[model samples]
Target: AQSVTQLDSHVSVSEGTPVLLRCNYSSSYSPSLFWYVQHPNKGLQLLLKYTSAATLVKGINGFEAEFKKSETSFHLTKPSAHMSDAAEYFCVVSDGSTDKLIFGTGTRLQVFP
Candidate 1:
């Protein structure tokens, strides 16, 4: 079974500081990974994705993730965080057999002024 684990349950950053949300995944075969963010009362928005094409994948809102097959990690990072960046982030992996998504517990990002 494929699974994803979010290393941090909570991450706090300043409005202009760098943000790092760690994630690790386990799969029997090549996996499709994704990062999704959800703001208060908002739906899950796709941040970035990796599907065997490129190792480094960039997404919207200055967010990006590098797929490291050797380490089995797909950590999300941003050069700087904004006040609007405060939200919940999820690390998801696709199950090869059923094409179902396996989501992480989630990491809450709090951006302080």
Candidate 2:
């Protein structure tokens, strides 16, 4: 079984401040983790992914995440926040057994001016 947990249901940040979104997971096999962003009234967009190759992965719009196997965590971060960054983020895991993504409870990011 593969499962994911996003630590925050909502995160509020100033436009110029930093952003952090925490996530944890458990999987029976080596899992492929992903971070996806959904803008208001928009479809999900792939932000980043962590396979077996790299522990640190960078995504668009200055977003990045570090995959920690020891902690079973993949936390998303950004150096600074933008008004356009306001969106719903999801943490996902896939082990290939079912070829389906196990999505975590989404974390909505609210960016303030």
Per residue, candidate 2 scores C-alpha lDDT tens digits across 1-113 of 78999999999999999999999999999999999999988999999999888899999999999999999999999999999999999999999778699999999999999
* lDDT against the true structure, each candidate: 0.94, 0.96
Candidate 1 on 49-93: residue-level lDDT in tens? 999998999999999999998899999999999999999999999
- Candidate 1's displacement at residue 46, Å, is 0.8
Question: What would the TM-score be for candidate 1 when compared with the true structure?
Answer: 0.97
**What is the model-wide C-alpha lDDT for candidate 2?**
0.96
User: How do all models score by TM-score?
Assistant: 0.97, 0.97
Model 2 scores worst on lDDT over the 10 consecutive residues at 93-102
Q: lDDT value for candidate 1?
A: 0.94
